[model samples]
Target: MADDQLGEEYTCRVCGFRYDTPTWDGGSGSHDICLCCGTQFGYQDTVLDGVWSVRAKWAAEGHQWSSPEFRPPDWEPGTQLAQVPDRWADASVLAFKLSAPPLPAMRTSADPEAQRAEVLGRFLRDGRLTHFPATGREWTIVLEHIAAGFEPGVKYRRLEIDKLLKAWHGKPADLLSRLTDQGFVANDDQYYWRAER
Candidate 1:
């Protein structure tokens, strides 16, 4: 069968486990319980606060897989937790061993931004954004890179801006909005220009 034959995998909001079935759907819970964190979508996780409450309890209990029988022999908690969406990424989960590796000491010697750029580069295809990153900083870096194509101090008509952004992304409206909203570009009703650095 083709890859498309496989349905989309949905992530558990509480523990970031990806399951074949939908736990929450169209503003309603499927009530499918997570095998990892034991979150019952329609029951215990009806609200975001409740989801975090369950996650906190699960973490306190050593982050054990709720359904050991369903867990793979090589299941790694840290690796699974990394899939949590940035919107729901819990700092408490970092107390577990799955957190990112510590940065090298000596802040001046180690360039964290460069390291992040290297990782972000993987999401690009031939200098065009393949998709936006979840984290704000990484997302900003991508927008900055795209915005750099515009020459500073040169005003561009809306059509020109659209054409320029289309070269970097298939849908440029949202990207253009973010660029102006974030001060990477300055614009009036009819014209836009790269913001002075």
Candidate 2:
């Protein structure tokens, strides 16, 4: 029989487990298992089955195209399609494992501005910035603590500048004014920080 005429057959090369056009409970296209070893194959593209006679041609044109980084090459004819050898299967599994990117290292900080920048940089790098909601004074406080090298997931009270100014009889404001005059601090929003330009 020509390969094109063959219908979909889920055959394990190891134990010779076979199923034909089986309805999978999960939407994912994974195979059930090997009849002999009972090892499960996650998923296979159903549309590509029997599209070509030679396994090599199917692998090159279909499998590789479907998953460029992880798909295994097609099995050769006369090769047992039922049960995959452990050694070869292990290599294919390793290839799939290596395809994922590594996770980022945890950050430590206490200063708000520095912490905020670091957190923002991490989110930007990992494409996770969108997960963060809008920024506010609470976020600013968190950033301050992070800049100070405080660990994440800890809470702290917000600083009240008015109390400090009252204790110094307005001396702190005078010093800030001096710094502003010297171009050391840029007064933009209510918060003061070093001038960017």
What lDDT tens digits, residue by residue, belong to model 1 across residues 1-197? 53312222366777777654465666776555576787776688656677678878887898886655456666666666666555455776544425544212211215877756664565588878786543345556787777788998899999999998988888889889889877899998889999976
lDDT of 2 by residue, 43-84 (tens): 332222321122334334532222122112433212333132
- Highest lDDT against the true fold, candidate: 1
Q: What's each prediction's TM-score?
A: 0.50, 0.17
lDDT per model vs. reference? 0.68, 0.34
Model 1: lDDT of residue 80: 64
Candidate 2 has an lDDT of 0.34
Query: Where is the poorest 10-residue window by lDDT in model 1?
Result: 100-109
Q: Runs in model 1 with CA error above 4 Å?
A: 1-13, 16-75, 78-109
